[model samples]
Target chain A: MADTDKSPDSSRRSERSRRAILDASLALVGEVGYNKLTIEAIAARAGVGKQTIYRWWPSKAAVLLEASMALSGDAEDEGEWTGFPDTGDIAADLKHVLRLTVDQFNDEKYEAPARALTAAGAIDRELGEKFTRQLLEPALVLYENRLRAAQAAGQIDADIDVRIAVEMIVGPLTHRWLQRTNPLTHDFADTCVDQVLRGIAPR
Target chain B: MADTDKSPDSSRRSERSRRAILDASLALVGEVGYNKLTIEAIAARAGVGKQTIYRWWPSKAAVLLEASMALSGDAEDEGEWTGFPDTGDIAADLKHVLRLTVDQFNDEKYEAPARALTAAGAIDRELGEKFTRQLLEPALVLYENRLRAAQAAGQIDADIDVRIAVEMIVGPLTHRWLQRTNPLTHDFADTCVDQVLRGIAPR
Candidate 1:
């Protein structure tokens, strides 16, 4: 086939089918979870040929990975992982983003799909790696970047290991959400910001 | 139906079957996960009739819950919530328990069963609350008591919310474990204690 044979119309058709496939994949994954989420199920739900999905994505993991990206708006960002937001007030910026996270955690639309992906990642290693590479590492880079900025501004101790420090902030909020241990709210977000900024030790 | 005339032999036999059932239930949950696990399977695996399982536990969740407590150790304490340790050095106690926690998180034997039960708890509120009571609350009380002691000692800020502070330490480690985001280690524990104690600000 000539280079001209790869035309815009064909590309558009492929893109539409791909979008349908991803939507169905994500929805089914959330409804039934990953193990029960199958190639046949996705095709049946998407109203597309199973061969069409296989032609584009290699496996259920690949399909779910892309579906999750679509769910997270990664396509618009392409594949570039820009790290955390760095407004001048590191504390406020961090709090602001965390507050948004609280909202996302509380939102039903986002929760189920995210849970589906996460549950699958728990037991499946290769899928887990794909999730880390495609979704999680990017989010973490943002944290690392924000911490580096804090270090540069002398807002944080220069000797601090930023990678581990990021977890200090994220781990608790995530723990609350994943474990359903407590209500994660704006007040909870404020508490997290307060504790992280001020030493827990008596000043 | 005279109570005093009841055969002790039947009751003893019933108690033995109960242990066998719980053991089999945990083994199946650890292997097949909660969703795919069944009463029939538990009964068959235990070499007991299905009626024997239903006569005690109401569902697979109940079975798993009892099995979880059984496998996690009989805890032999007087059925009360245990709080954190107090070496008077707040940081040291937190680190010591967390180091033990790192061992628990990495233990292959507990890992799958714990992960499966935890994942189920993630989406099911009633089950989640039960887990919090049976599995999580005891640990929290320990921290609560420890923090109270520290408050009295002025090791930590007196006005600080102990529950929130405890979550700060717990949230990150759990997020890392559940999300497959990173490793939890003794170094990770030490760093969390140091950073949290010092606060993230330049001291």
Candidate 2:
């Protein structure tokens, strides 16, 4: 309604504004941190009105979560979306997926916003739960499915809990990421895959 | 020098003040979060002068770190600090230690301040590194030593890196704690211990 332009033109403009807002949100969060980041600042940086932000998102946390999702979407587009890579070899498949995870973690686009959301998620339980369910759970489900496949193939113990087993593979890499203890490398990914499979395979 | 009273009375009063300041810092961080928490507010709530807080700790992070350390000290007093119990059963010992960790994480005294520091540390690299070194590394070293003992006993692969092996044990619990996905329970602890030991035991 605000636009004098046609429907397609208006839609394109709206998409541009949305991208700008998300980019600004990520940049500001990286520079100042999640706690100090404000919608007004995001609006200023994006050259959009505060009303434009509020119209699209409920809170700063919501905005950041969207920005994070956008980053994840871009990574998925970069060949990381190939789910679980079930090529009959569970270890190689897992290593492939985890190596891509390491790449995603190390990507400059993903780093700042992910860091911001994680910090915000720590104190704000509601936001944490929302992001976890919407963002994290879906990714974990892919792991769960892959593990289930491995179980069916007899590569893993029939008694192994796929959910917890998935945690074994994902947990260390996530710990390293959140703790910033070391570089999240392909080598580290390979090690995690090796250890986790060794744990779940029949004695 | 500032106290009118001398020796025993002054020392007792100083100790009381320190405890009060720590309590105030924890309470404020829980209520307002780490970003909003201020030393001025801590001093006011503790019924001490600003100078009193400054004399004891260098910064707000330092105060929270001390408070967090105090909670850790209390947990240690509850017999959790007894190190990895070597009953020759590495699985049982690691599970026992991890169970104690679940208890400490569940304790109310540790929750708020711990959450505050984690959130703060996510954005503030210096605080993260300081706490990681001072608080986290010591606990990790205990696990490392226990794994070394297991290696010597021929219970574990001598070639396994204790550093990454330790993460196999610690990472999942930490992930559960920070993510607040589920109750950090004895059963969870046992599962992690079983899975990790299975991974590192000689094939």
Candidate 3:
């Protein structure tokens, strides 16, 4: 085969292997949980050799991190996915995004793997930091950017720290979802946005 | 021996055994993490038989639950510890309590066991619900009661749902603590309380 033709063919084959490995990691972690997930199992499930996975990823946690990033639509080509929307109304825009978050949290496809990753991260500090940097930090940046725009538009108090503001808006939903304290619903998301916008103190 | 004398002697022995068991469970979980914690190790550490632990608790989670409750000063006879203070100033009271929580989360003695239990609960639904009900719900209720009192005093909006309000006040701190995304400090706690009260939107 010509060198040019060989390069594209090999690249396509490598891409297929990468996706299979990531998919296998997610499915295995969901079935057996993070603790039991191993390179051997992922290799078997992906129909690839253990060395193939090792060459591509450093550890099971690394593989799971990429899988989760891909699942959340924040993978390598994340620029293709537009971030938090600005409908010119911060309240409505926040609510719209949060309601979608509520749906994502409730989806079965996301739930099992998320629980596994979160559970693992809670116990493993090193893994937790990596997970946060790769999977969580990008998402937080989006919130910060949106809040910055709102501040510029005079929708938010200029004096407020947007980093802390972002946490206050999203933290309640994350807490409820993690603790399973109550049902996650669009109404709950809307209430959080409204309450944050208008302080709980008497108006 | 006199029957009355024997009664008191046996009761003292039982009380000593119970305290030992609870302490051992906490220490063992801290050393081994929750997944590796076992009834046998706790019994050995406490200098009691496995049957004694089994008699008092159904599983390792039950033992750990009681241990955590005792550590938090929320076990039986909790009235003496005093619930969330109602000092007529909601902001001051919340910041005070949250600062204390920051200290507790940072304590080395509390960190290991808490991480283990929290990690285990994240992956195990049955245990997670029990942990929430036993360890988390009471703390949340304290926040709820404080918010309700603020509402009654006309400090907070009467229309707000106290449950959701409580989450907003505490959730950011919890998120930061669990994720280790940032330092948990008195300043951070105070900021969270202030932000929730005054809100992010313009004055």
Among these predictions, the greatest lDDT belongs to 2
Better of 1 and 3 by lDDT: 3
Error of model 3, residue B50, in angstroms: 1.4
Number of colliding residue pairs in model 3: 0
CAPRI tier for the interface of model 3: medium
lDDT per residue for candidate 1 within B1-203, as digits (tens), equals: 11242578977777788889988887787788777889999999999999878878788888888877876564335332134567688889988777767777888666777888887776566887899888888777887788778777877776677888888777777777777777878998888887776763333
Q: Cα RMSDs of all predictions?
A: 4.0, 2.3, 4.0
Tens-digit lDDT track of model 3 for B1-203: 12243577887887788889999998888787788888999999999999888877888988898889888874226443466788998999989888877877898677778878877887788998999888899899988888777887878776776788778878888788778788898998888888787752334
* Two-chain DockQ for each candidate model: 0.58, 0.69, 0.56
- Give the DockQ-based CAPRI class for model 1: medium
Candidate 3 lDDT for residue A186: 95
Residue pairs in candidate 2 whose N, alpha carbon or C atoms collide under 3 angstroms: none
Model 3: colliding residue pairs: none
Give the alpha carbon lDDT tens digit for every residue of A1-203 in model 3.
12243577887887788889989998888888888899999999999899888887888988998888877764225443356889898889889888878877898777888878887887788988888788777788888898888888878877777888788888998889888888999999999898787753333
Instruction: Highest TM-score: give the candidate number.
Output: 2
Q: Give the poorly placed runs of model 1, Cα more than 4 Å off.
A: A1-5, A74-83, A199-203, B1-12, B75-83, B200-203
TM-score of 2: 0.94
| Per-prediction backbone clash count | 9, 0, 0
TM-score order of candidates, top first: 2, 3, 1
Model 2: per-residue lDDT, tens digit, B19-138? 999889988998888889999999999999999988778899889888878867776687667656899899989988988888778876677777778778777889888887787878
Q: Give per-residue CA lDDT, model 2, range A16-69, as digits (tens).
A: 999999999999988888778999999999999999899888899888888877
Runs of candidate 2 exceeding 4 Å displacement: A1-6, B1-6
